[model samples]
Target: IVGIDAAIFMHPTTWKASGHVDNFNDPMIDNKDSKKRYRVDHLIEEYAAALSAEGKENEAAALLASMETLLAKDDFTGLKKMIDDNKMQCAVSHTCNWTEIRQFNLMFSTEFGTAVSSEEGNNIVYLRPETAQGIFVNFLNVQKTGRLKIPFGIAQIGKAFRNEIVARQFVFRMREFEQMEMQFFVRPGTQKEWYEKWKAKRMQWHESLGMPAAKYRFHDHVKLAHYADAACDIEYEFPIGFKELEGIHSRTDFDLQQHQQYSKKKMQYFDNDLNPETGKPYGNYIPYVIETSIGLDRMFLAVISQAYEEQDLSLPAGEAGTEEKKDSRVVLKLPPVLAPIKLAVLPLTKKDGLPAIAEEIIQACKPHFRCFYEEKDSIGKRYRRMDALGTPYCVTVDHQTKEDQT
Candidate 1:
């Protein structure tokens, strides 16, 4: 019920201790034939998935095994060999001649305090690639200061940056984006139950946004992060295909435990309640974490793409027309609440105060919702334009508006 602006800054060493500084690096490989760089992990994963889909399981398994070795050592040459051995081509460049794999740090680096050069102080700081760390670093502070009970979650929506080598597929994968992340603190033994609960709740959020449940699916991760005991992605059907829109992870106490060990901070919670479940005093224990992370941009894209439609709409007869016919229309069937325009006030004719009436109506409704006033085109044309933009309704102010009502 209460909220405060918490000026919580993360400890720099938290990144180092979490193995973020070391393990957060992406294996990047360039296509020698096309001069395009790509994330090697993503490239190989895509290759494996495609091959498996094509019923080439043996080839995919071999390629995946080789990719694993290549990733472990950051070996570009080995990656190239695997690509050639598996006949895997770069999805972007569509070339098989891939350059050697190299580690690319996705973190955007900056210096704090002084104008120190990389050679001098080398005071390089990273813009967070993920918001989970921020919540992890503040675990003890929020627990003690906020007086939050166990199983309570700290929710945050913040900007995160990842230096993507190939920032394609529109907003689905962006270099800079907003993340709504929540880290739920729970007793160590009960992490699985909470993880499942969050996964269900997160999927419900997507459904609540009006996307069909059939268009969204849960993809359980066979290969989980080092910190994650379990992980799953909420994938939405995009224009291209189904892709990840959000991630739900059971991170356990890996983040807090790592930060505690690295920063020498004691991150522990005590359960005072007599064991209704265990009948024992819950000793000082590192709370396990259930994390739900969602990308706002991805959600926006899913909504936009899902709402976009091109169909033939029925039109009434006009001059010289005998029967009603289908008119080619590109309409965005956007949900009213999310539509860019709520209503448009159109004048059938620009003369005889018709436009004035429209302008007045537009001005009246402008404060309430987005409205468009147009007099340059015919009423039908104006209505079509508004419809194309997904305007929910169009109010035409013609001579009828000026006539006295009985």
Candidate 2:
């Protein structure tokens, strides 16, 4: 478990250094009929889902691939044509008419100080669109203060704000969200090896959570950002369909280089390790970064989706009564380590000092893990309640427990 770090609320120049002021944007389109704006990618994804639901899996797959190709090329006209050809309609208006796609900035900006001036030059500061810039700006301070060497990493988890034109799909996309990000600094030209290493390691970490491997896939970016040399997203199958859960990016010294130029600060790291190729110590150079960024909310949604299950627990015909009915339950089968309630202490009855015994158990286990105490209902009902909460273990206190301490 990593510790939470303070968020960075910095000058607008910091955002300009990070390129967020200019490059952080999404392609957006509006439905002419409904006058509703939609992110182009979301619109295509919805259309793809409709196709998949109609038993046109091949068509849906092809449509998604085409959309990706168009986006990679930044072919906005081709994208509009694809939408028209597919006859995709706006969900709200049920019409196919659409305006030309345009770029929409995602960063939230505000005036830095109370001023009567309407000028934006010195007054405007932006809520950081991402958390990595905070790490980048403080790289030297951390390296020098910690007496660090090359190949070290800095990790952070903090809130990021975005002015999303179309924020939907529950918490998957939000104006305010949390990001768990780590930036690993490595010597120049070693970035490729480290990138591959992190890609595999991150995938393994997800699998270690006991999630099905088939439920996750890596989507390589066809169109990389200005700062990225290599990048891919770990996509998970959510209730809304497959979507990006985390991103691994090979940012080749771009961030540090930009900060160096903008801040006029030295961002280079000196390496003492001998380079096998040159048979000499590697000299000072800006470290290339491998960034692993995950959306905490998206990860939570993925976990909950996998854990939720609907089960039928009806008895066999011979063991059932004449008026027997089918019984069903909705359960969250979360992993034991991830479950909110690890243990539940339920007394069979609230009387006869049973509640006291349960409370004792709660006090003991609460220090070790999360525990829930419930004694108001029947043992069977309490067990079901624990099941709904995804509690892995339940202990019952009864009359026999008072005698044998079992």
Question: In order, what is each prediction's RMSD in angstroms?
Answer: 5.5, 3.0
Q: How do the residues 232-316 of candidate 1 rate in per-residue lDDT, one tens digit apiece?
A: 9999889777888899999988988888888787888987766677998887889998988899999889988988888866778
Worst 10 residues of 1 by lDDT: 1-10
Q: Which candidate is the best by lDDT?
A: 2
Predicted candidate 2 versus true structure: per-residue lDDT over 1-406, tens digit per residue = 1222645588778889888888888899999889999999889988888888999999889988989899989899999898888888998899999999998999887776676666646787788888899888888888888878888888899999999987777899999999999999988888999999999999999998878899999999989988999999999999877899999999999999999999888998888889888999898899999999999999999998999988998876667966556888878899887898999988889799989999999998888998998877678877888888899899999999999998
Each prediction's total of clashing residue pairs, residues at least 3 apart in sequence or on different chains, is 2, 0
**Residue range with the least summed lDDT across 10 consecutive positions in model 2:** 1-10
RMSD of 1: 5.5
Candidate 1, residue 67: Cα displacement in angstroms equals 7.1
Instruction: For residue 256, give model 1's deviation from the true position in Å.
Output: 1.2
